[model samples]
Target: MANAGQKNRLVAVHLDESIGRGPPDIEHERAVAIFDLIDENSFAPVGKEEGPYKLNLAIAERRLIFDIRKEDDTEVMTHILSLSPFRKIVKDYFVICESYYDAIKSGSPRRIEAIDMGRRGVHDEGSRLLQERLQGKIEVDFDTARRLFTLVCVLHWRG
Candidate 1:
């Protein structure tokens, strides 16, 4: 559920291009995260602009771009963030996600659980970092940040 200040929530989200048709699991995760993100979220952009924002995310010129718009397709804001800050976290997240997938396939229950815990921790860190970076650009709750971070990782998948 969105809080009072969450009025600028994203009504739609699109990836500018496919991330190279990765593994099934990665595709699945991307699909689910995008669904969950749009289903309910808090995405208020700063300043006088109010939203039910539409977002198109992409990676270009070695930067992460946030193309935000209004419900009627009017451009509201376009924020470009540097990917340098996220490189390590995205890399770590990818590695842990692979480990988690493998653990699910053959690792012991204890090992799977432990790996899951680490995965969640890394995920939280990524989310926190995303929020910090987006500060003064957009306002998003922790849950929204987590979902958005997943989308960011998806964009990072290609290059």
Candidate 2:
């Protein structure tokens, strides 16, 4: 393992605030890129045979369990940068985040974002904001050293 101060990586996936949005309308190609980045360690997909191989991002050898279980037909991804290695290795990584309410199942704009603090500390406000912003949206917070970013995934369906 690297030293305590080694820099890590953060790969976020979600809506782009730049895109004029109800939620991030992530394209299929971009989606692939987001997933590819998280899989940088090449851990291999789990839960594939029985269901969509899934799990929150793994870090420091353990998995960061999702605040909520991911629903089918839902996806959230965004890119984050300048995060610390410790937090990058543990907090922000993800395999899946269930978005039932606004899930893509029905086809609506949903947003997913990951922030790299590149440091360490616990966050709760953003999580609460997500809960308030989108009914039951999922949020992931990472604490590396001081650098950190919040991953927000919002699911809303539209016809």
lDDT of each: 0.88, 0.27
lDDT of 2 by residue, 73-102 (tens): 334231122123224322332212223223
lDDT, model 1, position 7: 62
Which candidate number maximizes TM-score? 1
Give the alpha carbon lDDT tens digit for every residue of 1-159 in model 1. Answer: 344356678888998675576678877888999889988898888894888889999888778899999989999988999989899999999999999999999999999999999999999999999999999988899999999999888878853
Model 1 residue runs over 4 Å out of place are 1-6
The local distance difference test score of model 1 is: 0.88
Worst 10 residues of 2 by lDDT: 150-159
